[model samples]
Target chain A: MGINTFNIEEQGFLTTKLSEFIRWAQRNSLWPMPLGISCCAIEMMAFAAPKYDVARFGSEFLRFSPRQSDLLIVAGTVTYKMARVVRKIYDQMPDPKWVIAMGVCTSTGGMYRSYAVVQGIDQFLPVDVYVSGCPPRPENLINGLLKIQELIKKGVPPKRDPIFI
Target chain B: MEEKIDKIVESLGRRNIEAEIRQDPLGTEMILNVGPQHPATHGVLRLVLKLDGEYIVDAVPELGYLHRGKEKIAENMTFLEFLPHTDRMDYLAPLSNNTAYMLAVEKLFGIEAPKRAQYIRVILNELSRISSHLVWLGTFAMDVGALTVFMWCFREREKILSIFDIVTGVRFTTSYARIGGVAQDITDEGIHAIKEFIDNFPKELEQCEKLLNKNRIFIERTDGIGMITKEQAIDIGLSGPNLRASGVPRDLRKDEPYLVYNELDFDIPVYEEGDCLARYYVRLDEMKESVKIVRQCIEKLPSGPVKADEPKATLPKKEKVYTKMEELIHDFILTNFGGTPPVGEVYHAVENPKGELGFYIVSDGTGYPWRLKVRSPSFTNIQELKVRGKGNRRDDMVGRRGSIDTVMGEADK
Candidate 1:
């Protein structure tokens, strides 16, 4: 009744294109594979916690299994050693998955311009939305999630560039 | 008999049973890799567990998945520039990290924060401790299969973060503490919020405790599990609640009073059981103790300049920097080069929510520290996993590890 916007009682049936229906379904229920690597992970948890209540956006189900999740929230610093593991997890996730680079750390390496931290996760994985903040507040992260939802609704595929090692 | 024995041996060898029997009489050892990304390890901590059937034979905790080279980065940057980096170390209690690092640097410069500033620091430290313990309680309970407790704990934690927001202007990583003092003074609204939170938080904590404190499943799962002796705890260098839970009444706050801790009257909660449950009780009691401290700090809060009057060691006020020429020059120099401490080393430790967070700074009479070493408690406390995991069931590792409350950022750093 809310997002569906249909009067099935009058028509006695509901009709929609299969692709639109799939997109709608995918847009909702965007189960996040929480790659909570560091401080940003705390904010990511807060997003799921009661105050933020990510449930309203249908992203409350934080799937630990990459195979099942449709969204990957890279929530913290992805170091060089951890990059391989992150890429492996990204690869394991099924097609039509979107990634939300959940902090400045994940988005552009943030304040840590050290030898260990990876510059940005976009080099290794396709990022759908980049949330800015050292560790973005939960609301900021929610805004990022909403942007990802918008992309899904518009039927824009997650952009992927050829990874340079 | 010899012919029969030879035939049995020959048959065993033909089936390859003889080789297996000769290699090991009992074959029950299995290797279990816990994390690096697993939720229970609490951020990028991986444990290699050697298990004999259901029981763990040994555990090897592999660190450094989240090491951003904070100490090395500290050496390169000025003292003031490195403040924010401390926030990421113990991400749960960023305020405590900020306070500890600032205290260390202030010691290096031989300048103490004003009375009001010290009281404010104490209040912030306790608030962060409660928040940190709340997260630990929620996640630890969640690990023990009490999912509702996690929700309830976070609900209370959000209130604390709101208080943090009011006072520090940021929710999570508030680098509020500076080299000689705090970033700014606390507002009336912030004081009001702290008072309100202190009054109401214990009731919410009681509710969370009601959910798990006497619950049979929670008790059975944690009561005698992952036991550590007092001697073992001390030997392994466990500080904070972990050491206190093991019957050692050693707390850096009590033993070596830092900041305004000596002025405040608070009890260090101790439990002799040294199990996961005792650790839980100790933390629960500590949150109550923190509330008491906060109340006392609010009552005894002195009205004076929040930042120290040391011009060389402390940053100039924004108003002074804009209006006065000397202050302007001082601000420029401080921002560009930072304050230069004497050519010496100072080691300062604070009783963080996790444990004893010590910072050792070596000054080459320069703005930047020659070498900065962080003695993070989680790193020392995590060594107990090897000791605790032995003889415990493989599944019990989750509750056991969670009880210790090791934040990998601090541990790996």
Candidate 2:
């Protein structure tokens, strides 16, 4: 019999709701692979620091390895050259992954309208949430993380092409 | 290749050593690519380290990964429009970069900010220096596994960021400075907040020092790992705290003395040790000295107009332009035509947190700079890594973290 078809009622072991438990566990402890590139990276670091205390939300476990991480915080200017690296890191990350584009540069090319900078990273990779600012304040970063938690709790919506104006 | 090897072997024969027989020529050295995405490499710095069994044989750093072609972009944009772009060059001390670029443009226009503006610039620049060093300290300490110091340093840095947020609109990349003067005048509330930060920061610094100053692991990890001699430092053009740690008492604030720095009485700390620990100590002491300078600037701040009264060169405040007809027309002309600086090339260097951040601008009597070249300190400072990393073991790489503090943004720019 398939595991889904095998009734827990027949076994009578008193199990918790699998999807709810998975969502709760994933939402609470989202391991972030901090892909810090520039100015936004500093703000991201500040968010992880003592005063902001990213640990309070249990996302403080910044796993450098992509395989261990669920959330990718791309915090800085993503130039055309660095986009390949960003994509490689994203591809390496195990499935059910989320991306938080943590600056205007990542969401859409902020001020850098030149040949070197990638206009927006979303052309290649799917961005889940975008925290906008030249470099957003640590408080804004926290709110973005909370929003991600909310998304995880009530399943992430189907991927949509983000509008860049 | 065989002939060259034979010649080397023949030369070594007189010394009773065969060059070819020393080791098999077929043995390939292992190449380790250490980033473009490492936590310890600071920000997107890739080092291709060639190793012979844990000993770094040669290290070749790959640049241009973060290159945004800032100089080329500056050529297209108006001089005033380029002010915000300067913030990204050395993102750590954006105010310092902004000040340096503004001073360059001011020189080109043959104008100077009033005494009050000068004092405000000095205070803000010093605060930027302190904040930049705090980031270096936090990252460097974290690389060495001293997590407490990172937290302690960031706590102090958060206060500085909030201060910047109050004074300037943004927190991190604050494009606060303009050509003739600063974008906004420092209000009484901003001054009060800075004073409070200046008062409380020293105690916080002391706490940070207590955590890492004489801690056994901290010292062991940092102390003598990367030693740059006085001659080597001078030869390679190392500046800022990195140069000072090697016993060179060359500080731009003391040497150049731009913007009320001459009136300030502060001692430059120099250490003769020329090691990673000495560099760390030099930055620590410099932060205290920066506090002293900021205190002096605040006390002696003269009251006057922040922006220079040059309508052709400077745009009027939004409130003035909206309410007044003459100001609106003047703003329109200024924005559309832009300021025409004389056809001259001027290079202005500032003591950035990293090192001597110099901007070389060649103006062709147009609104846009003809040629803009940046002499970023991290560009030269990072070159010393190859020299320092040569003798150090692969494991010693982490220990040598505090020696060379390079922000790849400035380095690549």
Residue-level lDDT for A149 in candidate 2: 88
For candidate 1, what is the total of clashing residue pairs? Answer: 0
Error of 1 at B374 (Å): 0.4
lDDT of 1 by residue, B239-347 (tens): 9999999999988888999888999899999999999999999999999999999999999999998998888988899999999999998899899888778999999
Clashes of each: 0, 0
Instruction: Report DockQ per prediction, comma-separated.
Output: 0.80, 0.66
The most accurate candidate by lDDT is 1
Candidate 1 has a TM-score of 0.94
> Residue A47 in model 1: shift from native, Å?
0.4
Q: lDDT at B126 for candidate 1? A: 94
CAPRI quality of model 1: medium
lDDT of 1 by residue, A1-165 (tens): 224546587776777778888888988889999999999999999999999999999999998889999899998899998998899898889887889998898988888889999999988788879999988889999999999988888889887756542
Q: What are the per-residue Cα lDDT tens digits for candidate 2 across A1-165? A: 112434566875544577867887888999999999998888888888988989999999988888999999999888888999998998888878889999898899888888999988898888888998888888888898899988987876525434521
